[model samples]
Target: MPENDRLRNIRKETLSSAWYTLYRYDFEYRRSDGRWESRQREVYDRGNGAAVLLYDASRRKVLLTRQFRMPTFVNHNPDGLLTEVCAGLLDGADPEAAIRKEILEETGYRVEQLEKILEAYSSPGAVTEILHYYLAAYHPGQKEAEGGGVPEETEDIELLEFGFEEILEKVRNGEIRDAKTLILIQYAALFGPLRPVAREIQ
Candidate 1:
């Protein structure tokens, strides 16, 4: 089918472009019954991003980061401190390269072997962001510097490493609330290096 076969009168207006772009889209939509309806929706475009879950299979540990998020703070998150995998906006860079840089900047690990696992929209309803997810192995030798996020970006991140079981407990207790982090951890438990531990927990 043609991309716009079902509708017409599509138009968009830029609502804001201060930090990122926010667009208001007005279009006609074809319902299932073949009736056309006019609709309007707002979309926030902050560019695409990439994230990586750094793990140590030999020691059964995973590295994560803790940082404050203003959005979460205003949305009833008590402290707004989120525990998540190392992630960053692609900023026009390749997904793999972007994730590699993020791993170094947020966790101080110079990882070379990254396995791309998933690509997903951060929030499909209102945001235009596709997050590229990856998994990589890390060891003590890969720690080249103290990774606490870039000061220029006003990022104050704390590195956290936990045994596989301990991290799973955090997940069960709601300590790990970040969506990307939760998804990656669940993926690891189901099909990645943490499979054995997950099975044991069951």
Candidate 2:
């Protein structure tokens, strides 16, 4: 959907084409007083994505991933390895299907049940990607393989299994920084699948 009338005269120019597309936008922003001003902005279009927090009720553990992120490395992360939920671009698949496939690839979890929680723009100010969020439950018998993502994609992912309560502390202490991952974990802890687990903290 396009922006409403508060914005006008949108002009977009292609600026880069590496892993994702970047564009420069020149537009007119209408003031509340009915005045208008010229504005310019840049947006990165990496396409939309889906992510899920996978949990095992019996073990009170959650599935997470650890991998190097170049962006964070350059941004002062001595170790670029990030703890995150299973996530990936939709790439033409429906949101539900994409998260399921991501779980299988990133963690080897073959999930049978999924609960979609919310959708949000993780970085709306500069990025144009909307993320679909979900929660999934898994068991030992459902692990189909030792998943480390596809080798061709340069994905050398490491699996991280943490007790639900422990991971929340990781989040509180700034150990988890990936936006979507943090959101999903907190979602599960506060209002979604893992609410009971979080409640036990009190």
The top-ranked prediction according to TM-score is 1
Per-residue lDDT tens digits for candidate 2, residues 34-108, read 999999999999999998889898999998999999999999989988888889999988999988888888888
The stretch of ten residues in a row with the least summed lDDT in candidate 1 is 1-10
Clashes of 1: 0
Model 2: ten consecutive residues of lowest lDDT: 193-202
Quote each prediction's TM-score: 0.97, 0.95
Cα TM-score of candidate 1: 0.97
Q: Global CA lDDT of candidate 2, please? A: 0.89
> Superposing all C-alpha atoms, what RMSD in Å does each candidate have to the true structure?
1.5, 1.4
Residues 41-120 of candidate 1 have per-residue lDDT tens digits of 99999999998889999999999999999899999998999889999999999999898888888888898699999999
* Candidate 1 lDDT score at position 119: 98
